[model samples]
Target chain A: MIQLIAYLIIIVLTIIFLIKMIPRKLKKSPPYTCGEPMKFEKPETVFYRTLSNILGLKKLQKLSTGNLNDYLLMIFICFMLLLIVLVMV
Target chain B: MLAPYAVPLLICTAFALPVFKNEKLIKAIAILAIFLSLSFVLSSSIEVFNSGTKVFAVSGFKAPFGIVMVLDKFSSTVASLILFLSLMIAAFSSKLVKERVKEFYTLLLLGIVGSLGIVITGDIFNMFVFTEIMNIATYALIGFTAKKEGLEASFKYLIIGSVSAVLMLLAISLLYSHVGTLNMADIISRIDTNDIYLKTIFIMLILSFCVKIAVFPFYVWKPDVISGSLEPVAAFFIGVMTTTTVYVIIRIFYTILGIYYSTWFSIIAIVTMIVGSFLALLQKDIKRILAYGSISQLGYIFLAFSTGLAFQGMYHLVNNAIIEVLLFLSIGTMLMHKKMMEKISMYAFLLGALSLIGIPPLSAFFSKFFIITGLLEKNLFIYAIISGLISIVTLLYYMKIYFMLKQGEKKIYWPIIILIIAVLLLSFVPVWLQIFKGVEVDLLARNEYVSEVLRP
Candidate 1:
């Protein structure tokens, strides 16, 4: 049962990542843009501004081409570790 | 006798090659070492095929407790092919490297040693050690040119490959903890299929090797590595490097694990095929196109495995090695000159491309036919159909490259002519003889493999 659940979770996460990545790949987003369209403007949201602050302007541009999702990545990693521990235990 | 000498001879020569300052002598020794190794493996392969499995008990120790080498039909066949291909690549590219010739040839020979070790080793831990050796050599080889793209590609491959290696080591540790054995045959004898621990270990090992073989999610580094490396180096990577990884996969899942993860392998194979062919279709650069095409060809090998066609899969594996080496070498020659390809080179490329498409009369067709037939016999119509359809996609991309080729009147090189002749001979062999018919009997006899290793 646990194996099935683990497999399903991986499949779901992979599907979600693929959903997010296909568009960026199709558009061939430039580096540091995270798949988001570039425009001349200050940060529109606190999320964007704080992220840009942390990563710097250049990396923010690369990340915005929309490849990285910090929250999901953390969740996925945690889930994998949990699965490994569960299997081992 | 030759089985025991091949690896040591290659390793000694590899280390010795870099000690010499004479470029011409270094080149000669490198070629001579590879050619000699090729002959050694060839003689050993014939002996093994004619008689039975040959075991080389290392340092007066037998299997289970000692490091042993088993030259069965499978290992001998693949190892011989790899050594032969290494010799060809070495001879073909001897003059291509203008700088660091010694380091280049040294790493090349060492890499071949690693690959040969992986195929012949009976212990799981020895296999991992060899995997690392091969990977490290490859990492250096890819970055040898010191070009920006080569370094980036090498770095990327290193990151992914190191993680996979760690995973494999962990899997080995887990298996040892449970079975108290590092010998693959002994582990198989002790494995408990019902235990979740064993199941997890199985999954871990499969995933690790899957990464090595670049199945789906783990394939991100493949295109970059192939495109970034020098053409002959890329040929070596594509042709023999990937073949050894798949060999390990087969040895583990089919031989040691005794567990069939056919569904997962099938899913991975189908996805890899689709993604590879589609990406190949989209590429404009010649190397990138061939890289993606090679990825697609890997998918076909796994697809055969998924259908329980181990022999047929190996047949495809052999075919892919020959065809990819031919295609990469020919295209590489053309690209090196930056001129229109000679008519013979074009014909060679066409032969490779057509063979890859599974055109009848080519040796590749028989392998694919057998795989599809096996699938159909098992009522796996969907898989059979999917694989069949994927061949068309394979042909389409190959045709795109075919049309892109610029015809020239220059003469093809002698080495390339030899490769073309090799392909032709391989293609015609299946027509007149049932030489490979024994592979099925050899591969599926699990009990035979176990007894051969355990025998005093």
Candidate 2:
């Protein structure tokens, strides 16, 4: 039972991360599309809002002065952290 | 008899290649060398199957102490396939490569030599050395086009490949420290594999190979590498390189480690299949889709292994390699003949993709059917269902290719037609019908493998 729960947790986390990694084109109502109205009113698409918040997708876009290398560095750090967690856990 | 000559001849020819500067002469030499190598591999494979496993010890030393080459069913089958694919690629390359023909052929042959060495070597360290040789040759080959994307892809591949290699080296060093032997059979006999330390090494080694095979999460480097390299080079890497790498994985897990844990392989296989297929659905470029498609196909092969149907895995491995070569070669020809994939190439691509998507009455369908059956036999219903559903994703992506191709002009290529016929013939052949049952029994008897490798 414990093992099953652990597996379920892993699966949920994986899905979340996969959603985060998906390119903006694949995402529905990406942050830029959720603009003016979202600032004052709650978005009708709860899923998009949650994803945006969890992934910090909007913040990254808003702060987008970074180059390709910086993005690559970010990805590398995330990958290393994931690997470490996988191995140690 | 011919099996022993394959590696030496390839290596010698690779070195001899630099002496010639004329492009035609270089291409001819490369083709000749690969043809001879293929002939040797085929002849030796026949001998191996008929008379049982053949062992070739190097420098007058016996097994467990010196390097020995083993020619068994698995190694011979994979080696023959590699050599045949290399031969085709060599012959077809002349039409594609314009400059540095000598370097290209040399690296290509060196890659062949290294892959063959990995297959046949009994010593684990030699396997690592050969892997590095194969990797170096591949890195150079990927950079051969020297476009911006090609160089960047090659550099990225180099970094990822180096990390994998280091992990493998660390695993080897750990095993050596524990068991005090480099010979696979000797180490298998001496080491206590169940120890946590050994298990750690095993995971490390498996992760290293996972990187090579482009399993999920580690597969990020593959699309760029495939897209940046020449079409035929991409085909060879997808088909032959992965075949050899999976062969080593089997060798290590089943033969050397002597441990079976289907759960881990199954989980990873499932993830790889889903992620690969899903991502493939989003790709627009034909080659990138196929590259991602190869990842999904590998997931099937690994899934078979995870179910403990190694014979099925081997069967699917060969089937997938054939499909990959056919697809990539057709794509290459089409690219070379025109800017867009025309009618004939589209037909060729459709045929390959159909086979890949598990259309009935094709070799790929048989392999996949066998794999699913293996999953069912093992009572892995979830995996069986997952595989069944993944085929839909596979079909969708392939249909995307088909619809895209529908827009292109029609023209026929005879070579592709010949490959189409071969694919059909293989689909209908019952050559494996009688043997696979026996193989299923034999693989479960793991002692058979250990005894065969260890017999003094």
Candidate 3:
């Protein structure tokens, strides 16, 4: 445990020192939209949509649509599943 | 000696808070009430640790007849932890909660009183009552703002929570019919684990608690609930509320039933872990992400318990509660001071996120390490590996929040600072002290608990 703490402190200090030692300069760049205000969707919306699609969670996400009926149905299914498992065991 | 007074003191204070018209006084009285209760809990914990289990039979009525509050090492530790967090949240909310001051403080204290009762009560029926008390207060707190979204979320929670309550009541009734007593110690002596009826009853009870803890399939209400509630209130829900429910599972499975290590239960926990983590990754809202993250952490605790790693589970319970509270309160600070997000808020969130991801020398790291090692020892290599991979997913979601934070101001939030220190100090706990030794032993020693509570 002592060794672990020592290593943690060392790692943190090393990162801080490395960051401080690195030299960098800030440069202003033109807007990527060519001076037009970009019309784009919220990044989180697009990211979540794509990820959900890739993971095939669209059905699961739809089921959890915050509807009262959907919530009750899920509860009912879970209860039945629990009952089945316990009885079998 | 003061163990029995903790819940009633909070209850009386909660009722009395509304009489005072001054909001600052109301907040002060609420904080004072929690502080007094916390002191009582801490003193009782010291006594219990020094001696053994202490049982307080209500109104001088003995066990199997009247409700009793049992203060073993496990209950004392958990109760103290809950009260401490409640005290922190009470202080934090003093600044955040501007409207309905009296109602907010009253409901917060009442909710905390219910959680305290759940942790300390010896009667199964009494646990159910406290669970309702906590849930009702939680529902009110969630809808305290009375905004459309808040009311909608509270209504959904109420619907699902009522279903859980009915299931718990049904289980309690079945158990009473079988064993003829609601006293947990007495039921332990009478219950036949192999009996199918009793098994069904236990399953009902466990399923109800799983919903309360927002395990997968029943976790749909959580994100909305967290997103809708006031941030400090959300912190209280994620930190104290779910931890207390997990404690109920521990007390029931380990002590009342004396049945440990269920493969089906472990499978449920694993599924909850995987599903919650993945769903968290796909969330856009910070509160929703933390809600799902909390669900995944609950899965870790359940899995630890099902695998017979009671100590590891309890340790992780404490660590997870602290980390969640830290993160939520920091986010609350950021939301409050949006124009200038404090540097302290950023550091607090980052530290909490790192700790949640099980970074080295953090408290959660040790708990996860012990749990994975225990799983490996049980030849559950797949479970161990999945648990490890879930940590990476945890990192991803937390980083999503990290990048969203805009830090500028040098102002400090004392609560977040205190919590950050608490998280750092927690990592030093196991090595520097043996606080959990008695709790770990007491959890597995079902016969000892029974004999203590049933002693004339």
Candidate 4:
């Protein structure tokens, strides 16, 4: 359907634009060693990374004024859809 | 000829999206069109309410021959709710929406126009078209910002919405095959819907509508979309759109489906409330909390409708519209503050949360009482218990929020407005019993409402 094609085109183009624009807005730096970009030539494994001392798992859990509103809102709205499914049943 | 003006007007305005290059002219036109559309809604709804039903043959075609726009008590009731709230929302937008004003207002009008069309049209195919219109507007509004969270919420909504729309279209297609027509009344009355596929279509519609209303399970998208938006926009939909969609569900289920046969609906209503309340308790985000709160509140709509108390159901619906407007508006107002905004909003949030949990004298408490009593009167014991337990859970979570906010020194006069809601719903009970003739009997519902939506 034409509508389906339009939807695909719009979504694809938007995603492409987002990928290009967002990274351009950020400063490029050699990625940090902990989060270093894995080379395509050599495959990376979780066990390998742990043994290689590349990533610090505990470092990710920094103390901050956590804002959970956005995530919680998503769950709440999804619940609405579930309610609808129940109603339809 | 005149029957389709609402949808046509919206389409025309939307078509100009490429022309105006901005939404200003279209915004002005939208306001004018709504005022014009309100007249039609008022006139036709009034006629239907008084005479029972009014049928307009679209372009002079009759029944099976051509599209018919029928105005029944249910249709008119919802039309009044949608238009009057829309008018108020438009007025609210004068202050609320400033950035991207043209596009925002156009989308707002488009959504309203779609809902209006859905309420007024008697054709199933027409309903599908309007659903698309309404759904598109919501998607645009939710995705108005490209923030990561905003886009994520919209993406989630887009996926669920696509599924529901597909199911709805399939159901409509199936109905068309069976009846060889898309007119609602004709299909219901002429065809033997006892077929298994009839059940399938019913399930599909109920699924679609539940998503629209943001009831339990399907409600996950509402908190994100509503709370994730900028404050004023959140207020607009939180205050109006979600409630309007619930009204849409009521109309579609009871009137369109003519589903007076089963208590299965009551069961679903109970589930939405229980799940909603439990979820609300676990939420940390103020908006997500409110979103869950709304889902729990809608539980009452289902409870009342299943009890076969139509007036009671309508009463709860109207009460919610008022409460949400006040609560969200206060939130919007508090957010407008500079230094004390964070603290003040926390307090306002408490007021809203407390009211939602049925704190005494809050509109929610009294309205909730009416629902419980009404259900008990109908001997729906299990439903009343489930609904009441959910209320208790609501009370617990709301109290928690209230204490948390009270811990802060900076406070606004949130109680002054909170008390206002209590008094309003309290007055409704006396007014309903005719114990107080303070206002005209006709305005018993409208007077309690702070919003300018006059059903008459």
lDDT of 2: 0.75
Is candidate 1 or 4 superior in TM-score? 1
> Please, what are the lDDT tens digits per residue for candidate 3 over residues B118-178?
9989999989999999999999999998999889888988988999999999999988988
The DockQ of predicted model 3 stands at 0.41
**Number of the predicted model whose DockQ against the real structure is largest:** 3
- lDDT score, candidate 1: 0.77
Measured with C-alpha atoms, the lDDT of residue B291 in candidate 4 is 69
C-alpha local distance difference test of each model:
0.77, 0.75, 0.85, 0.61
Q: lDDT winner among the candidates?
A: 3
Tell me what TM-score chain A of model 3 achieves.
0.42
Q: How many clashes in each candidate? A: 13, 2, 0, 31
Q: List model 1 lDDT by residue over A1-89, tens digit each.
A: 99999999999999999999866764674334777766533222333345336634443123212122332243235335534753564
RMSD to the true structure for each prediction, in A, is 13.0, 10.8, 5.5, 17.1
lDDT of 3: 0.85
What lDDT does candidate 1 reach at residue B401?
A: 83
Tens digits of per-residue lDDT, candidate 4, A1-89, equal 99999999999999999989756544453235578763332112333334224433223212111234443444445545544554465
Candidate 4 residue-wise lDDT, B1-456, digit = tens: 154355535544765556765545655666666667777778876665455456667787766567766665555656766666565556545555657776677777778767777766768788888878877887777777666776766676676677678767887888788668776666655555456667666666666667666665456566767666655456556555666566556655554455543566677678778766666555556566666777777878877766665656666676666566555555554444531334544544565566666777665676677778877877777777777778777776565444333232354443324434443644456554332122112222222221211112
Name the TM-score of candidate 4: 0.70
After superposing the true interface residues, what Cα RMSD does each candidate give?
11.8, 7.8, 2.1, 13.1
The CAPRI quality class of candidate 3 comes to acceptable
Instruction: Give the lDDT of residue A20 in candidate 3.
Output: 64
